[model samples]
Target: MQAMENGGDLPRRIGVYTVERELGAGGMGTVYLARSRGGRAVAVKVARPELAADPHFRARFRAEVEAARRVGGFHTAPVVDADPDAQAPWLATAYIPGPTLAELIERQGTMNKEQLRSLGAALAEALQAVHACGLVHRDLKPGNIIMADDGPRVLDFGIARAVESTRLTATGAAFGTPGYLAPEQAQGDEVGAAADVFALGAVLVAAAGGSAFGTGTPMGLMYRSVHEPADLSALPGELRSLVASCLSKDPAGRPTPETLLGSLGPDPNPSPDPKTLALATADRPHVAPPVPVEPPADHGRVDEPLRRAPAELSRTPRVMILLIAAAAVASALVGGFLALTRHGDDNKGGGPSVTASDSRRATSQASTPPSTPASSRVAAAPKDRVTVVVTAKSGRSWISAKDHNGQILFDGVLDNGETKNFTDKSQITLVLGDASLLQLVVNGKEVPNDFQPGQVERLTYDRSGEMY
Candidate 1:
C-alpha cells in the first residue's frame, strides 16, 4: 500500500479548487482534498515535476485525462476537471470519502466470501467502463480501491498511461506496484486491458489474506509474478478457480472484465456501512481533533522574513562578504600572498540594503556560496551529520524529509509562519511540494535556491551544507 502521510502543504488553490489538505501521495503526484468555489469536495492529483517536464508525458497525460473524463460508472470515481497544460498538470475527480480497501483490510482483517464477490463484481464493472474508453488502469491494488458507502470505487484509472514512457520508467523500472502488477508488466512487456484483470486477481488475493506470489522484495515479487505460480490457498474453493484464471501467465489466458462480471454473480450480503468500518478499524485510540487556529495576518505575504536562527548572520551580509573575499583573493593571489579585511561600513552604506521585495532576485544572484577546500570545510563538522531548518514564509507547503536509511523524519504540511528543524547523523533528503512557500537553512548557513512558485524541489544535504 502507498503509505498515507497526513496534512501536507496545502496550496491556497489549484485551478478553481481550494485545497484543504493532502490526502496522499503516489507515483503520479500528491493528491489533495479540495473544494470547488461552489463547495463540492474533489480529489485533485497534480503530476510529479519530472512527469510534467516531459513533452511525451504531457501529451499522453492530456489524452488520458480526456479519456478518463468519458469513463462513467457507479463503481469508479468520476473525473471532474483537468488541466494538462498547466505548469504542473493536474486531474481532479469526485472525492470518495472512506477508508481505502487496503486500510479496511488492515483494520478488519480479510473479507468474507460475500464481501469478496461484491468487491470483485464492482471492480470488474469499473474496469469494463475504463476499457470501453480505450484506457487501462496500469496500477490496480487495494490502495486504489475506496470502500464508499454504496460500494467499492476505483481511482487513478487512465492516469498511469502517462507514466509508461516517462524518464521514471525509461530505466526499465516497471510502472506499477510490485506484488499487484501483472506478469507482463513484471517482464517489461507491452500491457493491455488484461493487465488490470491480472492486478485485480492480486488485489483479491490480498483481500483474502494472502499474497498472490507470496511476500518478498520488489524484484522477488516481480520474478515470482513472471516465473512462479500464484498461491491461492487462502481463497475459498468457489472463488479460487475464478481468481486463478485471472492470474494466468499469458495475457490471452485471463478473463476479460465482462467475463469476470458475468461469473462473479450477485452479492448475497452487502458490505457494512463505511462509517462503521472506519470506526471498527481505528489503528490507535481515538483522539479529539485539534481546535482550529487563525492564520497569521501576514499569511501569503512574500515579504515576510523566514524564521531565522538567532546565531545565524543576515543573508545579505554573508553573501557580500563571500563575493568581496572572492574578488580580493582572485586579484591578490598573483603575488603568492592573500589578505582580506572587512569594515563595518560595508554593512551600513557600501551598497543598498536588500529589502524583502528584492529577496528573490538577490538570492538568485548569490545563491551559491564560495567553495572552500575539503580540508577546511569537512574538518570542522562530522562528515556524516547534517541539519536542516525549514520555515514556511510566503505560504503553506508540504514537506517530507528522509534519512540515508530511508526512514521518514517528517512528512506533513508546514503552515505559514511555522518552522521545523530536522537533524540527522547521515544524509538528509527533502521534498518540497511548493518550493516558493518556504526557506531552508542547511547546517548553520542559509541555503538559497532558485525555485519558482509551485515548482517541486528535491534536495539532499550533508554536513558541509552542500546540496546534492
Candidate 2:
C-alpha cells in the first residue's frame, strides 16, 4: 500500500461514499480512499473504461462481485458494497491500513522462520474462505497481501476472474504477475484453486528473499516456471519442502490450503495491540508509494526468444512452444511498461507507447535550455509561488498533482515526451507512478531524485522550491 494522493479528475462521490482522495491506480481501474455517509473508511475500486465498456466483462464482474462478497474470513478484507450496473462498475471494501508484504520485505529484509510460518498460515486460511466461496484469487503476489496489526489481509480475491476471457486474455496474454504465476497459468491452461497455492508458494519464496525461479524477462520467468525448478536455497530448511510442494508444476500435486494451514503449525507471535501498530506506522519514514498496475493489453505477443531457456528441449511440448513464442513477441513489444505493470505499479491502461520521434524531441528539449536564465525565471515568479514542470523523459507515467488546499491540478498518464506544468501559491503535492520515467523541474531548476525504476513517489514542494 502507498500514500494516497489527490487526483484532479477524481469523482466527488461514488454510490453512497464520498471520495476523499486517490489511494492508487492499476490495470483494473483507479482505487480511491473514500468515506461512507456514516464516516466509515472504505477503499473503492472503479473499473477502467475499456473494461467497463465490455458487456461480457461486466457480467463476469457482477458475478465475481457477488462471489467476492460471499468470501468471509479474518484474514481477508471484506467487500462492503458494489454497483456493477453503474456507468462505471465499482466495488468497495473495508479499508485496512498497512504496508504491503512487498514494501515490508524491501524495507526490512527477509522474514525469519516464525514470521514466514505465521504469514503462510494466515494467507492459507484466507484462501480457504475464497475457495469455499467458489472463487480463486488468480493473482496472489506479495503486493496483494497487507500486513495489518492483527495479521495479513488478502485483497482482490475473485477479481481476476472478471478479467479472464476478456479481449486481453483472449489474445493469449496471461493475467497475473509473471514471477509468481503457476505453470498452468503460464501455459494458458485452466486455473483452479491449486494455482493460488502455487502462487502462495512463490510469494513465500519471495518473502524469504529468493526468486522461486531466477528473474530475467517476463517471458523468461514464465518459461522457467513451466519447465524449470524453483531455487529454494534461501528458504529456511524447515519450510522448504512445504513451499516446494506448493510450487509443483502439476496442480494435483500441490497441497490444498487446508493442508498448508495444518502443516504451518501454530502462530508463534500473536497480533500486537492497536497502539503498537499505530506507533510503528508513525515511526517509519515516508518512502515510495505503490499504485497497482493492470496487466498490459498488448502483453502476449511472441517475438523474443527465452534468453535463459535452452535453445531446444526434447521435453518441451508443441503447444507450450507456441505459447512461449507468442509471449516473447508481446513482451518484446511492451516489455518496459509491462515489466513494471507485472510487478504491481501504476500503469493502468498500459499507457501509450513513446515513439522514436518523441524520444528525439525530448532529448532535444532536455539538451536545450530556455532563453530565460534560471535565476531570472525564479526572480520573475511571485515570491510566495511554486512552479513545477514534469516531463515524461523515458516513458509514460501516471501523475497526480494537487495544491495546498487539496485541489487537484493535474491527474492522468503523461506520455513520453509530453510535459505538464502546475503552479501553487504555497505548496504543491505531486505523486508520480514511476518516478524514474519522468524529469522534474521545480521553480527554475531541475529537481534531483534517486528514485529507482518503477518506484512510485509522493513529494511536496513549498514556495521555497524545496521538496519535503
What TM-score would every model get versus the actual structure? Answer: 0.56, 0.58
Every candidate's lDDT: 0.68, 0.69
Local lDDT at 168 for model 2 = 39
Clashing pairs in 1: 9-397, 9-398
Candidate 1's residue-wise lDDT over 1-468, tens digit each? 122255445577788888888999887888999999899999999988888888988998899988999999899999999999988899999999999999999999998778888789999999999999989999999989999999999999988778765645222222677778775554334578888999999999899888887664443455346534677777766688889889876676689999998888784444466676667666645744334343332111111112322112123221222222234544332111111111111111122223331232211011122232212332344446786777777655655566665444554445555555666787777656556678787776666756655454456787778865
Would you list the clashing residue pairs of candidate 2?
26-292, 27-294, 301-326, 301-329, 301-330, 302-325, 302-326, 302-329, 303-328, 303-329
**lDDT tens digits by residue: candidate 2, 1-468:** 222255558788899898888888665778999999999999999987777888887999999999999999999999999999988999999999998999999999999878899899999999999999999899898988989999999999988778653533111122667678776565444578888999999999889987887765454566557555677776776678889899876676689999999988774544456676667767665733333343322112222223312233223221121111222434332111110011111212121222211221110112112333433444456767997777777755655566776544554445566666677799887656567778887887887756666554457789999865
Best-fitting candidate, measured by lDDT? 2
- For all candidates, the clash counts are 2, 10
Model 1 regions lying over 4 Å from their true place: 1-8, 169-174, 267-468
lDDT (Cα, 0-100) at 107 in candidate 2? 93
Stretches of candidate 2 above 4 Å error? 1-7, 169-174, 267-305, 308-468
Tell me model 1's lDDT, rounded to 2 decimals: 0.68
